[model samples]
Target: MKFTLLLFPLLALALRSQPRSRTGVTEHVTLNLRPGISLETTNAGAQDWIFQIVGKWSGFQDGHWGLELGDAPTAVYWFFNWDSVASHQEFTRSPEYPATIEKVESLASSFSAPHVPLQPFPPREVFASPVVSWVTFNLTGVANSTATTNWQATANDFLGNLTRVSGYRAHSSGWEVEDSRVFSVLVGWESAESLGAYVISRSFAEGFRRLVSGVAWEHRVLRVAGYVPKL
Candidate 1:
């Protein structure tokens, strides 16, 4: 009875000493800027307006976000770092968040829903060095839940092959959101040429056929502006 009493206080102390923060992850939003709008102008507006507000918001002591441009004049990407899913969710409820979204949506023709990395998926490993190509895909036609599971398994096998290619920094493939069949895959490369070389090679052809068949996909390659280390 005395030993049990002593152990209980120690356990209570240990639990009290535990940190409150959760593992950090990146929040991504792919924007389709308004038609005929130049990326330069859109980016300039974002820097002036959207970036400014998100910077002042709580839980973003790191900085607001990073921006990138893809192939088209209308394509833009926003990447924000947050301590956890709850932090990001909490930010959305802030008064400034809705107004910020309203201003940003005004610039885009359409935008993909914000996509944060899902749990049970390992936290992302972000390289310190900037990547030359940031490729993103929006995919559909994944029919049923079982098919989705099979696809993810096949993708895991495919990722094993992709990592062998030189200059492949990081790659992750998963659903764009939980409870949705639509999915996304983001890959980083050393350069556009490096990615091009791999795409045309025999190895890529085989994997692409197996994993991508029957899926309708839209993709764009972005020139990453800066790199953010994994938090």
Candidate 2:
């Protein structure tokens, strides 16, 4: 199946009845592997350390960590959902926190962890999917109400088309809490090839052009190898 770019002006109104809460926090972590370190090595080390600290952290709802595909092959993307920012901060005070950081730092040359409240947090199936796409868009300027409204309409239109694409599984998005102008979207797909095919399609071309017009954005496709806590 292929998606088609089409406007649905009533999309927002149709979704109005479905309340979307921004209570939870999603931590997005990027780990750039150190020189000479293979993805296999990092995965193995992760299993022994970071992965083991999952349930131990209070408020940890769900987690997914996987090696990135395409451009940054040696990088890993880790997504962790928590009850709230306070919950995540509480975890940082735990004894295991330092040890976990030490283990991750050993394998990574550099890393960054940014927390955001992904409105309508993605379900577990999204992370369980074979491939995931992480896309971020930085608004050209301060996002006023007008800009946000326009973006939302364009996004809804684009997403409406996206759902029709073959292999599209699930998606979620939100603006960065620390930087409201930075918006991010997470999409799950059956395979990287499926996502690539969609990206080159006319639907994508038109939708993406409208969505990102005058905005700076980047994306990464990840081959999900495993999920934290095995589910």
Q: Pick the candidate with the highest lDDT.
A: 2
Badly placed stretches (over 4 Å) of model 1 are 1-25, 35-45, 60-72, 118-146, 227-231
Q: What is the lDDT of residue 35 in candidate 2?
A: 73
TM-score per prediction, in order, is 0.68, 0.83
lDDT of 1 at 122: 37
**Model 2 RMSD vs true structure:** 10.6
Going through the candidates in the order shown, the clash numbers are 0, 0
Best candidate according to TM-score: 2
Ten contiguous residues minimizing lDDT sum, candidate 1: 1-10
Q: Please give, for residues 52-138, the per-residue lDDT of candidate 2 as tens digits.
A: 685567678878877888654778778888777667666666777666666766677666666678866744667868999998888
In model 2, the worst 10-residue window by lDDT is: 1-10
lDDT at residue 7 of model 1 (Cα atoms)? 36
Local distance difference test, each candidate? 0.56, 0.72
